[model samples]
Target: MYKNGLKRIIDFICSLCALIILSPVLIILIVFGTIFMGGNPFFTQPRPGKNEKIFNLVKFRTMDNRKNKNGELLPDEVRLNQYGRFLRNTSLDELPELINILKGDMAVIGPRPQLVRDMVFMTDEQRKRHTVRPGLSGLAQVNGRNVITWEDKLKWDLKYIENITFLGDVSLILQTIGKVFKRADINREGTASDIDFGVYLLGKGEVSREEYNRKQAEAKELLKRR
Candidate 1:
């Protein structure tokens, strides 16, 4: 009872206070993101929320609109300019998600939302992460962020979903504060700070025992190196 009721109270109070306190920073981010990205200050994308519901997740635009040969977009690292990189490194890009929390599309603390494409790839057990509303800062984000593999992040998300509580959320939120200050796991080596779920999926094989084995082996090696 306390878990359900207290959690909602915490969400309401904290979100309201945060929005008020951070309004100035939020406005600045909006203007900067818009000017940098050319039109849309906000980047909106469909992400799976609680119970697999689709919601528009919003973030500040942190990448420029520079494309490459054949008019296709260049890699994120290439397009991420200095200002964009600053927003990402400080996690200022996530400021727009306060609107999501206000609209009931997210919670202040829960498993971070996954893209719809990535959600489609979730295993049956992994899908349990969707049982609660997504969050701006989750267990996975605070623990490892881009430093951890997708599989490990998913496992952490699932574990958090299974053990969610008022105290757990508070603890996770506090820990996230520490991570932000420390700027841990901001990016992977040789890659941009942000991840494109679509591109990541395309590189993996979804079928055949041999394909599965190969992917698993590669994932293991990456994990060992990390």
Candidate 2:
């Protein structure tokens, strides 16, 4: 029923309507983001979508492109400016993902797409979140978002895919609205973004530092082709 096909229909209709209704906000974000974010107003990255497919997930760029002495991009905290913080806190930065939903790269609700690096670290069981389209807002997001442990996040994602229903999606959507209004769990502890899954695994002794480095390198190489 809903999971098989109806959900995609609703996601498309809702996102199309949302794009129309939110056009003004999107335009303003683009104008201001371009001005304050140095150049590019949008942040795009290769995210793992359904069945581990890669897609360019789009959002407003919240961090400036700053590099250290070695020309490596600075850490997220340093690059995250006040404007970026505002966008993050309000979740206005995510508005551009309507385009993703519109294009069928995502859904209005489902398991959120994670970084390619994160995807590589996922077990085969956990990666099953991709059985459905990625989401703009997801079960894991409303539960605890970036503050939740990766283990719990993956658990919720797996739970969502087991049985999706119209009522369930609506409930999650409503819960997501409330979470956004409260600006709850937007970031983990004091950081500007969630800790990388690969980093988390390294800390938990699940993966050796060498393995982490190697897999991260692989993810970077994959991004180059995207």
Candidate 3:
């Protein structure tokens, strides 16, 4: 009962209240973002949501759009400034997702949405994570977050899906808050961001370079539908 219905109703109410309560913090971040991030404070990306549906996921911008002399964007490590790290470490970068939650594009808790390219590479069993709305903080998040391997992340996600309940979600939420307060598990082992699924697979020799490129083309074509 809670998994199929009560979850969304509670998610809506909680996200609405969270937005109302956190408005001041949001405004402060916006001002600081203008000064430090150079302009826009929000980042939007097309992500696969429930049932692999595409939606733009919103979050506070944690990387500047700095470009090299050639006019192309610089590497991600170069663009992720100190302010960005602070936002990421404290999990404040996720504040804007309350809007996504309120808008019904996400849930307060579920599997974190991955890139469209990542979606295309997923096996049908792994793709089951999309059976519910993506989330702001999830089992994978609280369980080791970006520090965990891609396989472990999906493993936890499936575990959560197998047993979503009101009490279970509440427990995860509490664990998330504690983890955030401790500033734990923000970035992966050696990278500033989580590793992309496609890249991970290619690195592990699970897919050939040719297959990777082909699937990327497939993902791009699907993305064009929006």
Worst 10 residues of 2 by lDDT: 217-226
lDDT, candidate 2, 56-157, per-residue tens: 999999999999999999988999999999999999999989999999999999888999999878888998898899999888999999988999999999
Question: What are the candidates' C-alpha RMSDs?
Answer: 7.0, 1.5, 0.8
Which is the leading candidate under TM-score?
A: 3
Off by over 4 Å in 1: 68-70, 193-226
User: Which lDDT tens digits does candidate 1 get at residues 1-226?
Assistant: 6456776666767778888999998988888777888878788877778887777899888888888778988877788988898988888888888888878888888888876656655678988888888988988998888888788888899888777777888898899989998888889777885454434555664455564455556544533443
**Which structure among the candidates has the greatest lDDT?**
3
Question: Candidate 1 versus the native: TM-score?
Answer: 0.84
lDDT of 2 at 219: 87
- Ranked by lDDT from best down, the candidates are 3, 2, 1
How much lDDT does each candidate structure score? 0.79, 0.91, 0.92
Worst ten in a row by lDDT for model 1: 217-226
User: lDDT of candidate 1?
Assistant: 0.79
lDDT, model 2, position 12: 92
Can you tell me which runs of candidate 2 are displaced by over 4 Å? 221-226
lDDT of 3 by residue, 17-109 (tens): 998999999999999988899999999999999988899998899999999899999888899999998999899999999989998999999
Clashes of each: 0, 0, 0
